[model samples]
Target: MTVRSAWLLPGGTDSPGQTREDTRLAPVGTMLPDGELGTRPGVIPGGDPFAATGAGAMSLQVATGRAQVQGTAAQGAYPVCLDAPEVVTFADGDAQFDRIDTVCLHVYDALFDTAGQNLAAVEVIVGSATDTPTAPTLDPACLPLWDVRVPAGASAGVGGIDWTSALTDRRRYTAAVGGIVPRGALSDVGAYDGQYADVEGLLYRWSTADDEWQLYRAPELPVETITDGADTATGWTLNSFDARRHGRVVQILGYWVRSGETLTTNPNIADTLIATLPTGWRPVVLVEAIASNGYGFGAVAIGTDGKLTVRSWAGGEKANALEKDTNVRVAATFVQ
Candidate 1:
């Protein structure tokens, strides 16, 4: 075992913990029911279509841990509902979010009636969530609705920071963001109802009677989201939140890295990486920091003698070579 294996052995599991992984998720809306995943409204108790319907209506359900909703073609300007608690309950119910996550807006290409016309811009409003006016004609920079092209035949769904999910539970409400709709419908299109566009957006309503969760897709408000930051090494366009970093125990904070056979690296590289990043932003490095945490994978420095001999790695800890001058440690020079 070399110096790397010594500390890599495990400091015991990192205490049974739950990572909120950042409780915010960007809210997104779109007109088409195809790609944008959300729980659509009015699905029967058995996942059947309801006889009744409403404007900009669609289907909604919880799948593989996401509250997914689907949209349709005849959609009018309506807000989509999301049942955060139910979807969230599937994961860690204790996860709490104080502010709205980044909103994920989508105006499905189908929602646009622009035959051959070009789009100028889109608008968004943090309706109902705040005392602010409903569907306030927000500016472009302020709204995340710029360049959002609603293809000739797709539905529209907008997303961004709305601030409606943070209601106090029977104890606190999930921090909910407002609407993610279109900009003036862009033409003689529908007017922004400032109401819930899809039934899915109103999935989880607070029950004052039982003091728990209930279901309702009222046209109105909501938002929370999490993502894996670990590295897969399989070469996916690494996002800043990978759950693991390849195999090294060094990616706990999220940064890009590579290694060489006879080269050197700092054991405290994590601290250094964190020091270099901006204030609230973390590097895109993730690792199986503690055992029982992930794939339980590892690496070792082997010796030619076939014995796992532990050598001193002064590579970055001390000097260039621990066996030579005490001041000249670190760099391994070569490996057996």
Candidate 2:
């Protein structure tokens, strides 16, 4: 018998043997002459075909072998599967999926927020039973324009950062330089009784243990230069009164010289409260003066309508009227 007749061809017993005119011989357990064995031409490798497509493209399923296609064409992007819990990993580098319309994948162990929103775009798993692909880690420098992160404090009650409140009904405290918290009402009697808060630039703080919120010195005291406004040519010495702010109070500390020199028409009013205190601010306490001349003592008081009166005396109880060189030093506190 000839070599073609000795072979068992793929057609059934009702079909004839391989004829001499037929150049392509396909058998049950042999490779095709061009090394492919699927429904379409130049498609699969190994033995049997898996499933047929309407476009005549057949899937190659392996019982114990792999069917790899290595080409740049669109038909070369076929997935290889193994038997029973075996994972088929693609080769490294960009294995392009050409002209794919829709892709549906199943992700495991994803995270979500309280409002049922996905927390991450893609999650990286470290290790799996079948595959050990390198997982990715987080990097802060690569954040998007509007990325959300969960802070690790009392403010994390809601779903992460408040992006919606910042977009819609924004508040001034939410954008403060030193950072801010939500506006909280002053407690009646608590540990935070004297604490302060800023609501849209309106300052408010607790007064006492049992008090509600009150405006905590809103309009700051204007910085005033307390000079005698005297000319150097007149040979008249100038007095100094320096004021500085410390929280809700102001501390005025300076020295006043009772320039005892003889007067030429009052010489621009010496040591008689030569400054205008702001409307709602006045001295609340005046410490004792460190006497220098005259029978001195120091006195500072605030009128009921917010007026600042500063005085100094020496050698006993006396009025604040100054005589030449009868200097007196004073320290006082004021509040708004």
Candidate 3:
């Protein structure tokens, strides 16, 4: 029986026999979806796999890790692993120039390697030396682990590489085939833009332009209530005052009673201050909403300065009048 057929059926009296190549193909088949044979390649996220660290002046160490690679032309999927930390060193820096070197995990198969050894190894691609250098090109069978920046005149002893600021992590992770990527597996790689992630039961999309994860739905801020007397208007006791935000919308609800000084019907009350909203609850433009006094209906305006002002009154009530010991209800919704 053929190698593919050998693994396709259950063993039955010499009818089929599985080979090593068939066993290797099992993971690849399981990881790729139908009609998408060899498209995705990435590290399996867990235990800080393949994390890079500074070993010395010009050397960096890679921790034990596991990853998968899809060969070109969708030929096969190969699983790679590093059982122990491996240190990779670099040449001394150029006299007057800096360069970026890429550390990668390269997978070699008998089909592609002249030596015919199917294995994975750590390798570095040296970059060009210049004032402004970039990472080197990577082979299809390789996964970049990190980018190390070697400044000019850097050496092993006195003037050496600064471990803290020299390493730029470039590792990208992938999830199982036909699954939504979790928050822990999210990558900053721009190539994965438009990918979706499940973060704490909320869906987020990767935005390449912004280089960040954006919420798929509008964010709802927590409702904040104002109960302190310091935030209440003078002579006005708050019954209920609160503010909440959802996306670009700001809403405020307040019910207050005038307990002390009351305005007379002589002066204008078009801009009389009722209460002040907190900073984040303020609106860009004036927001006018219908308010209810104990006697009749009136209008209140929320301004950019966060002040809630009485605008007008109706139903035989004078516009310039505010009754004493009466309750006022104001609610306004506006875009920030």
Candidate 4:
């Protein structure tokens, strides 16, 4: 194929001499300009495209499909399409040893070949028979779609291939240029550092250092209404009580009024149980925070048993007392 220049120039006049290479180079040029060459080759997402199914005997059938491949810049990109379902047959299994084979889409370009024939076809690349069989190596122009395991002495009858479990779907998908990849299409978590994927409505970023997908944003945790219990039993009316967790941190927000009798001289008044957090919401260890108690500031502690206890009051004439009919506020944050 002759390399053409000045093909996609702006304000260029149309010519009847345009060939298939001209049309193919247009999209490839568009994708290349935006650093999209780094985008992995894959099938377009939906319609169960290119699904492989067992077809009797030693044959396997592939559904109609479409895929994108980033071949060398000299060869340009390939938008491969299968107009109709194609059946691929494999050689029968070895009589005494199991083998593995790979189904792949192979791209043939005249630019890189001695024969000036350009074509794209689906081919089954057979593997070597071995006690521990492995899939075959693919050419740079080939994209794998599935792996088939042929058991020892397997054939068309009672010991034929078990279509149910012998086939492994190796299909993966690529996103539109600059779009977030779907989590299901991520075959290598560490392939692209900082790549983002949408996982169940949440965004996750690939972390190559950790070899994992880390949450890209702060997670939205459900705010739970704190049920009034021990504090209410002592004539304390809760105004607003809520709790929420973000990762390992749990935060509490609450307000209440001591409307009933308040102990003025009781030394044990600091051990007042206000409420209990739910099992999973409790802190890992005792955590304390300062809160407003009547006319003074008081210490509040949350224990591992989920108990919220009032420690003691300061900044008031009454050392450890809670005046009646006074308002109190509680706001604490701790690691669970």
For lDDT, the strongest prediction is 4
- TM-score each candidate: 0.14, 0.23, 0.50, 0.54
lDDT of 1 by residue, 218-291 (tens): 45422212234232232112324322222221122232222212222344111111112222223232211211
The local lDDT score (0 to 100) that residue 257 gets in candidate 2 is: 61
Q: Which rank order by TM-score, best down to worst?
A: 4, 3, 2, 1
**CA RMSD for every model?**
28.9, 28.2, 13.4, 12.4
TM-score, structure 2 vs. true: 0.23
Scored by TM-score, the top model is 4
Please say which candidate is ahead in lDDT: 3 or 4. 4
Residue 321 C-alpha lDDT in model 2: 34
- How far residue 215's Cα lies from its native spot in candidate 3, in Å, is 4.6
After superposition, the stretches of candidate 4 with alpha carbons farther than 4 Å from their true spots are 1-38, 157-159, 183-194, 198-203, 207-213, 219-336
Q: How many clashes show up per model?
A: 95, 15, 0, 0
Error at 309, model 3, angstroms: 36
Residue by residue across 1-336, what tens digits does model 4's lDDT show?
111111212222344332223222123222212143444676766688899888887778888777776566556556776656777767677888998888887666656865344556577787888999998887666678899998888777645788888898777666665466564433454355666777767877777688788878765775554444323435667777777767678778778777777756464554677666667877898899667865777787888987777777765446667777777888888888
lDDT of 4: 0.67
Better structure of 3 and 4 per TM-score:
4
